[model samples]
Target chain A: MNAPVPGTPEHFIANAKDRVFFAFDRSDLDESAVKTLMGQTAWLKTYPNTKVTVEGHADERGTREYNLALGERRANAVKQFLKAQGIADARVKVISYGKERPAVIGSNEYAWAQNRRAVTVVAK
Target chain B: MIKVLSRAWGRLGAALFAVALGVAGFSGAARAELRIDITRGNVDPIPIAIPAFGGGDEQSSRVGADLAGVLQADLERSGLFRGIDPRAFIQSFASMQVQPRFPDWQAINAQGLVQGRAEVQADGRLRVEFRLWDVFSTQQLKAQAYVTEPGNWRRIAHIIADAVYERLTGESGYFDTRIVYIAENGPATKRIKRLAIMDQDGANHRFLTDGADLVLTPRFSPSLQEITYMSYYNGVPRVYLYNIDSGKRERLGDFPGMTFAPRFSPDGNRVIMSMARGGSSDIYTMDLRTLERRRLTNTPAIDTSPSYSPDSQRIAFNSDRGGNQQLYVMNADGSGVRRISHGAGLYATPVWSPRGDYIAFTKIAQGRFFIGVMKPDGTGERLLSDGYLVEGPTWAPNGRVLMYFRQTPSDSRGRGGDSYLYSIDLTGYNERRVVTPVQASDPAWSPLIP
Candidate 1:
C-alpha cells in the first residue's frame, strides 16, 4: 500500500472530514464502500504517527442503549476494515455516539439514513 | 364421579374469589394505617388546584395550558396528589394571585392551591412565577420563579412537581432523577444493546454509546448523576465508570479477567463488583477514592450481585456457595458472612432495600421468575409477582415500592420477544407498566432529590 502525502488533496478527501455512512441498522461494508475506505487506509498507513478516532452513531428509531451498541458496532466495523487495509490496529480508537448526535433532524427514514453513520476524526 | 368433580371445582373457584375480595378490603385498611406511619394525616394526596397562570396573551394562554397539563401529569403519576380541574375554578388568577378565595377552594374539598403567571420575556425566554398555598391553613407553602427556554417548559413543570412532592411527603422527591438502561432493538438472536439515559418520566432521551459492544447492569451513584456499568469494550468484559454530566469514562481495574454486575456504595466512595478470574466469580470492592482494591469474598463458588446497605455497614449479595443460589449478608468489611434466605428456590440479584428494612430479590422457582422481598434477617418472606423472566429489582426512593424488568416469551416464530420495566408496591397491589420507547432492562433507581 502506497502512503499518500499529507496536505495533499487526496489526504483531505480520504480523511474523516469526508465522513462515511452505513446501511440501515447494518455495520457491514459493501464492495464500493470498502474500496473507498481502502484509499483512506493507505493515507493512514502513510502517516504512521497520526492517530484517528472512529465515532459510531445510530438512527433515532430504537431505544437509547441499543442504539448506543449499534453505533459501537458500526464504528468497530470501520475500524476492523481499516486494520485489514494495512493500517495498524493501535492507531484506531472507537466510541459509540448512539443516537445523540444525529446528522438530520426529521423522524423519517431519509433522516435516519443520514444519522446511521460513522466518522473518522484526527485524534492526534 | 365427573359431575362431582366439576361441582367441587366450581365451589373452589367461588371460594377463591370471595377470599380475594376479603383480602383486598383488609389490605386496603392496612395500607391506610401504613401511610399514617410514613406520612402524617393519611396524606390522601392533597387535592390542589392549578389555575392558568395570568398575564399570558391568547397565544401564551395556550402555552400556560400546556405547561399546566404537563405539571398535572407529573404530579398525578407520583401517586401523591389530585389536581383539581381548571374548569372548576370560581376565581380567576387576576383576582386570586394577591389573595386567593380560601372558602371557594375549601368548598371544593381542595386542601392546597397553586397560582402562577407566565410571560414571554423580551429575550424570548419564558418566565414563570408560581405560589403554593395551604388552603385550610391559609398559609403559603412555597413560592418561586424560574426562567428558561420555551422548549424546557416540561422540565419546569417537573421542578414544580418535585417541590410539591417534597413539601407533602416530608422526604426528597425523585422527579429530577434520570434512569439509565439497556435499550434493545432488532431481533432476539441479533439484538443490539446500547447505553441510554433519560429523565425518570421518560423525557430528554439520549444515547450514551453506540451498539458496538455489549453493555449491561448499569448502576447509578448516590448523587444520582454518575453511572457504573459492565461493558465488553476492547473485546474484554470489564467494569467502567462514566460521569453523566461530563462525557468522560475510565476503566475500573486492570484485572486479567472478566468483571460484571458493578454497583456503587451508598456513600459513592467505592464500587462493589463480581470478578470472574477463573471459572469461579467472587465479590470484590474497590475504593474509588484511594484506588485500592480489596477482595470481599474469597470463595471458590459464584458470589455475584453484591449490594451495600444504606448505612454501608452491611452488604447483601447472592451466592451459590451453599448449593443453590441464596441470599447472604456480610459486614461491609467482609466479615460475619451469614445466609439469610431459606426459601424454596434459587435467588439471584439480591438488592438491599434503601430503607434498611428489607432485601428485594429475584427468585426462580418452578420454572418461573418471581420478585419477592424479605426482612434483613430472612423472615417474613413474601413473593410479589410471577413472570416468564423477571429480574433486577430497584428500590423507589421511599422503599415503599420496587421497579424491575419482565421479559415475555417469544412467539412460535421466535422473533418478537419484548422486555419492559414494571413497578409494584411492596404490598404488591399497584402493579403498573412504565412506558418506554423500546425494550428497556436493568433499571437502577436514583435517590430522592434533596
Candidate 2:
C-alpha cells in the first residue's frame, strides 16, 4: 500500500541488521520484502543495546512436532540472512513455535500461508 | 398283589448286580493315584485389604476414607488385584498399626495388607506413613512416608499402592505416575481436544488449557513430571514443551517446516521428532542444550513416530519407504538403517521397549486395529489384542505388559462414539479396562519412581 521502504541491495549487504530476512515458502526474497528488511536492519543498528529473538512458526496441515522443527528452520534462515547483511550474530536468537502460535485461525490455505512466518521480537 | 411282588423281586435282582460292579470299580480306584490339575485359578483378581489409615479426626478421617476408596478402585480397575471389603476387617486400624496379628489376617485369607497412619503436621502439610505387609509371612514388604498438601490425600494413597505393587510383584509400580492424553469431548466429525493429566489411576484430573484449537499427541517426559505435545494454536501443528510444575511452556527447535511426534530421549536431554517440509516427513533430533539439530532421515517417504532406545544409542521409527508403513531401526547418528517389520499389516507408532528388548506397535489389518509387540529383529510377532480401533501401545516400566487405547464401535444409529484406555499382560491374560470420566486416547505410561 505505502511506497516500499527505501534502501538498496548494496546498503543491506554492508549493514549487519540486513543480514536477517524472511522468505515466502521456499522462494528466495522478492524485491519488496528485501527492501522492508533493509529498513528494519537500519533501525536495529540505531538501537545497538537491544537484542532480538526471531521466532518461526508454521501452519496446521502437517504433524505438530514436524511443524515445530520447520518453524525453527525458518527462524534460523532469517538469522543467517541477517548475519550476512552485517548484523552481529550475538544480537539475534532463534526459536520455532511450530504451529503452537498462529496469526490466523482457520483450516484454509490462505490462513496457513499467512501463519507460516518468522517474527522478530525483543529479547530481554 | 402278585404283580407287585414280582416287580420287587426284579428290583432286588438289579441291586445284587450293582453291588458286584461296585466292588470291582473300588479295586481300580485304589490302584490309580488321584490327580487334580489346576491350570487356571479365578482370573477374577487377587484379593487385597486396605484398613483405614490410623489417626485422623472427623474431617481428616473423611479424607482418609476417600483416599482409601480411590486406591481400592485403582487396584480393582486393573483387574489384577481385588480389594477386600473394609467391613470384613477382623481388627481395627489402631490395633493393626501397633501389631498386625498374622492369624487374624490369615483368617480372612487376605494375601496382601496395606496399613497406614495420617497426621496433620504443624506446617499444615499432611504427613502420611504406610507399610505394605504379606499376611502369610507377617513380613513388612514396603514402608514409605509422604508429605503433601492436605488436599493431596488421594495422591498419597496412590504412592502407597505403588509401593505395595513394587514389593509384591518385584517390578516398578506405575500407579504413582500421571498420564497426559488427548481428551475428546465432542462429536466424531468435529471433536474438541484439550490436553489433560491425572494420576495414572485417574484421580485429580485437570485440563492443561482451553480447547481453543486442535491439540493432539501429548506425551510425558521420562521423569513423569513434564509434558511435550503438539498444538494447532496458530494454525500450525507444532511441538510445545510444558512443565507440569511450573505451568510454563516454550516452543522446541527452530526449523523452516513442521515438527510432530515428539518424545524425550531417555536422558531427557534431546528430543527425537519428525520434521515435515516439501510434503515429506523425516526424523530429526534436537539437542536441548546446544539447540543444534541433525536430520536423521533423508528419504522422500513419510517418516514419523520416532522413538529412542532406552540406552539412547538407537532409534525406532515408522516409515512408508517400502510403499506402506512399517517399522525401522537405525543408529543414533542416522546410520545403518534397516527394515524390521515384514508383517501382513501396516504398522505405525513403534515404541522401543524400555527394557530394551521388544518393540511395541500398532498394527492395522483389514480395517481392524491391533496392539502387538515384536522382537527388534521382527521375529516373534504377537498380536496381544484386536478391536475396532486400538492404538498407542505404551509399555509398563517392567516391560512385561502393555497399556493401550481402544475405541468402541459406533452405536446402532452410528452417531455415538466412545473410547477408553486398557492394559494387558504380554501373555494376553489379565486384560481390563481403566475407568475414566471422559473419553481418553493416546496413553503414555511413565517409568517407575526413582
Candidate 3:
C-alpha cells in the first residue's frame, strides 16, 4: 500500500492517531495527554473542513453516572484545548459514553489504563 | 395495616396454653411471647412449620398449597425464619378450624406454626384466614383474614406473609415491594440497556423501556407510580421522568449540557440531579411543579449522586472536590458543607437509609469495590460486602436490607461475563443473590405499594 499524499484527509487522519489518556477519577489532561492533543491540533488545522467528535470514556472503576460526568469533562477538555489552539469549536463535537464504551475490556490495571481515554473520531 | 383480631375461642385457647406453660415460671412468659429479636438479624433462622391449608374446594385447595409455599418463601427469604421440611411433620394441618397438636410440632423442634383456611365465597372471591401460633406455648400470636378475587392469589399470599413477618420480627415486611433496575444485553462495548422492574421476590419481571438509547441510574420516587432516571435519548444525557402507568415521558429541564445521577426528593416533589457545564459537573435540584432549578453544589469538581435524607432536611452526596471521590453532607438548601467520608478509599453513591440511621455507599479501595454503610457523621464505617465489582446500594423500604449489583470480570475481549443483583442484611450477616431475568445493575427499591 502506497503512503497517502501529504496534507490529504487520509494523511491528516493518520497523523491523528494517538488518543489521550487520563488518571483514575480525573478528567484533567496530563502532560502526555496534552502532548498528544498538541500533535492532533496540527492535523486538525490542516484539514479545515474536517469535523470530529471527541468521544470521552472512563475506566470501569467508578459509578456509571460519575464516570459519565468524568467522560464529559475529558471530552470537553480535548475540545476546548483544540479550540484554544485555533480549531473551530463548531467542528469539535463532544459526546460522553462514560464507562459505557471501553476501548479495552478487562478488569486489570492494564485494561483500565487503555479504557480510560478520549478518542477523536473524524465525523463523516 | 390490618390489626390482628383474635377470635374469642382463639383467645381462650391461648390463655389456657399460657397457664399450662406458667408451671415452668421463668420459661412461661418468654416462651409464650411470639416476638423474635431481629436486632442482629438472627443468622440461625427460627424453625417454622407451615402445613398445607384446608377447607378449600379442588381449585381452591391447589391455590391453598401455592399460598402456603409463597408464604414459606417470603419468611425464609427474610433470613428470620426457616420453614421446616414438611416430611418431618408428625401432624398434618387437615383443618384450620382445629388447633394443631403442639406435642407433634415440639417433637420436630418447630418453634412457630402457620395454619390457614381458604374458601370460595358466593361472589367467587377467595377468603383467606390465617393464624400464627407459638408452637411451644401453643399461643395464637396473630389471626387475620383477607377477601380478594381468586386471580390475585399471590398478593394475598404476600399480605399474609407480611402479617406473619410483622408479628414475628416486630419489623415491617419488604416482600410486597418491587425493584427497578437496568436490564442489560449485548456486549460491553455496544451494550443495550432497558429499564426493568420486578417483584421483590424476582417474579413478574417486565421491561419498562425499549433499548433504543442508553439509560442509567434509575431511581424510584417516594410514590411508586413515577420513576426518575438519566437517559441519553437524543444523543445528550438528561434527566427524564417516566410515568409507569400512563406510559408518558417528560424531560425534567432543558439543560444545555448533560444531566445525570438523578434522584427524587423524599416527598417526591422535586428531582435532584447533576449537570455538567464548562467542563465540570455540579449538583442541582428542580421542582417538578414549577420547573424552578436550584443549584446545590457550586464546586468546580464533579459533585453528583445527591440523595435526600428521609426527613428531607439534609442531603448526602459524593464529590471529588477533595481531590478524589468522597462522601459529603450538606443541607437541603446546600448550606454547611462538610466532608463525611475520611476513609482511605474513594466513596461514591451515598444513599441515606429510609430509617435514617445509616448512609450506604460504594467504596473502591485497593482495586476492588465494596458496599458499605456509615453513620451520617461518617464514623462507625462498616463494609457490608465486597467483590470485583459491587455497587449501587439501595435500601429496602424498611431499611433493614440493602440490594446492590455485582459483576464478574469478562474475558479480555469483554465476553462471557455476567452481572447479578445481591441483597445483604443491614447488620451485614446474610448476603444472598437476588435473581434477575437478565444482567442487572443500578437497583432502586420502591416504597411499599399501597
Candidate 4:
C-alpha cells in the first residue's frame, strides 16, 4: 500500500467529521445530522471510487437486542441520505454494532449523546 | 424405562448421584403449620435453624457441617427464611440424630429445624439422611436421604433445600439449578464479554468462552446442557449454540442477515431468534434437529426476543410494529397476532415464564428501566424492580423467582459504575444481588437439573 494518499480512508477521516448523532431511542436524522451527512455525501461524491462502511451505534440505556435493530435503522437512515445525495447505494455498506461499541465510556447524557452515533468508515 | 433413566441420571448428576431415599409425606394433624407465602408483601422471614449435620465418623461429620452451611445459605438467600445463629443453639450438630428436639429449636425462636447425618458407605459413596421439622407444631415436615460421590456434596445440600422449600412454600424449588450469564470486563466502549456459567449459588464458576469475540444475552436450553447466544465473531453477528458439557460451539445457521436474541424453546428442540436484514428485523425459529428454519413474524417493524410459552403453543415477543416497541403474542404457527403490552413506556425483551402464567419483560419509561411481569393476556401488569438501568429477566425453574441484571450510572467523569445480576421474588420483594466474578449481565437461569 502507498503511504498516506489524500483520498485514502485515513485522509478522508482526518479531513471530515465522519459520524452523526441521534436522539435517545430515535433513529430519524435531525438538522445537525443532515448537515454532517451532507459533508459525508460530498466526500463520497468527490472520491467516487472510495467505498465506505456506515456503522450504527446506540447508548447504553436500550436493551442489547432492541438496540441492534435500532442501530440498523439508524445506519440505514444514514446510508439512504448518502445515496439520495448523489452517492451510489452500492458504494455504502452498513452494519450495526448496537451498544456493543460506544464512542465514549461514561453513562451520563454527554457520553450517551456521543455513543448514539453512526460513523462512516472507509475501507483500507 | 424409569429404572434406566435413573441409572443414567446417577452418572450424570454432578458425579455418581441419585435420590436413594424417597420423601415421606409431610405429616401433621395441626392446621397451624408454618408457611412462607412468597407472593405476599410486608411478610417477615421465617426463623429457621440448621445446625451442622452430624455423622458416625469425624470425616463425615465435617462433611455434614459443610452441607448444613450450604443449605442454610440457600434458604436465607431466598429471603423467605432467616437463619437462626448456630451459636445460640441449645443442641449440637453431633448430639442431634435423625430428628431434633422441638423444644431445643423452639427455645431459639426457630419456626423450622433441620437435622441430618452424613456417613461414608462401604463402597466409599456418601450416604446422607435429613429431616425437616415444624418447630412450632412439633411435627416432621419432610425426610429424605441420598447417596452420591463424596465430592458431590453441595448438590446434596441443594436437593435437601429444594425438598424443604417445596414442602413449606407449596411451590417447586429452584435451588438445584444453575445460572448462565455474560461476564464483562474492560472499558465501557470496548467491553469484553464472555459466556459464563455457575451454580445458582455462584459456585463452580467457569467461563465457556475466552472473550475472543463479543458475546451477549446467553440463554439456557430448558431441556439440555446447551445455551444460545449472539456473538460478533469475525465481525459478523450471528446466533450460536454452545454445549456446556462438551465445550463445543457452533453457529446456529448461515442466515440471510444478522441474527440475535436467540432462545431455546421449552422443549429444547428449536431455537427462536431474530434476524435483521436491510434495516428491518423479524422473529424466527429453527428446528435444531433437521436445521429447518421458519419465519414467525414478517412485519416491517423490528420484532425480536421471541420466547415460547411453557406449552410451546404460543410465543411472546416484543415488536415495534405498533409504533412504539411493545409486547405481542402469536400462535406457534404464526397466526392470530395480538399486542399484549399497553403500558405508557416502550416494552422490550418479553420472556414468558415457565409456569405459563406470566411473561417477564424489560420496560423503559420516563428515563428509567424496570423489570416487570404481566399476565399473558397483558393484564395484571406489575413492575417489580426499577433502576437507572435494569433488564433481561430470566425465570428460575420454579417460576417463583426471577433473575435480572442492573447497571449503575457512571459519573460525568466516567468513573464509579458497575453492572451485576440480581434476583427477586415473584412478588417483587426479596431482591438480592447475585454475586458474580465480574460485572455480569444478560442472565438466563437454567431449568432444574433433572
Highest TM-score: which candidate?
4
lDDT of 4: 0.87
Local lDDT at B119 for model 3: 71
Clashes per model (N, Cα, C within 3 A): 18, 36, 0, 0
What is the Cα root-mean-square deviation between model 2 and the actual structure? 18.3
| Order of the predicted models by DockQ, top scorer first | 4, 3, 2, 1
lDDT string for model 3 (B1-450, tens) is 444222222011111100011111113445547577777654588999988765557877888888889889988988888999999999866676577888899999999988887777787777777888888877777877776667666666777788788878888888877899999988888889999988888877889899998999899987788899988897877899998777788888988888999999999999999998777899999999999999988978989899999999999999989888999999999999899999898999999999999999999999889999999999999999999889999999888999999988877977655778999998887889898878999999998765
lDDT of 1 by residue, B177-260 (tens): 567888877665356888888777887788888989778889889875579998878756689998876768789988755677
Q: Pick the candidate with the highest DockQ.
A: 4
**What value does DockQ give for candidate 3?**
0.65
**Of the pair 2 and 3, which is ahead by TM-score?**
3
C-alpha lDDT score of every prediction, in listed order: 0.72, 0.69, 0.84, 0.87
User: Candidate 3 chain B, which ten residues in sequence have the lowest lDDT sum?
Assistant: B10-19
Which pairs clash in model 3?
Answer: none
Per-residue alpha-carbon lDDT of model 2 for B202-273, expressed as tens digits? 766888868887777777787656778877677555778888766787888667666788899999888888
Q: Name the weakest run of 10 consecutive residues (lDDT summed) in model 2 chain B.
A: B15-24
Here, model 4's chain A TM-score works out at 0.94
Stretches > 4 Å off in candidate 4? A1-3, A85-90, B1-31, B93-99
Compared with the real two-chain complex, what DockQ does model 1 have?
A: 0.02
Model 1: residue B120 alpha-carbon error in angstroms:
4.9
Off by over 4 Å in 2: A1-124, B1-44, B95-97, B121-123, B409-414
CA deviation > 4 Å runs, candidate 3: A1-12, B1-32
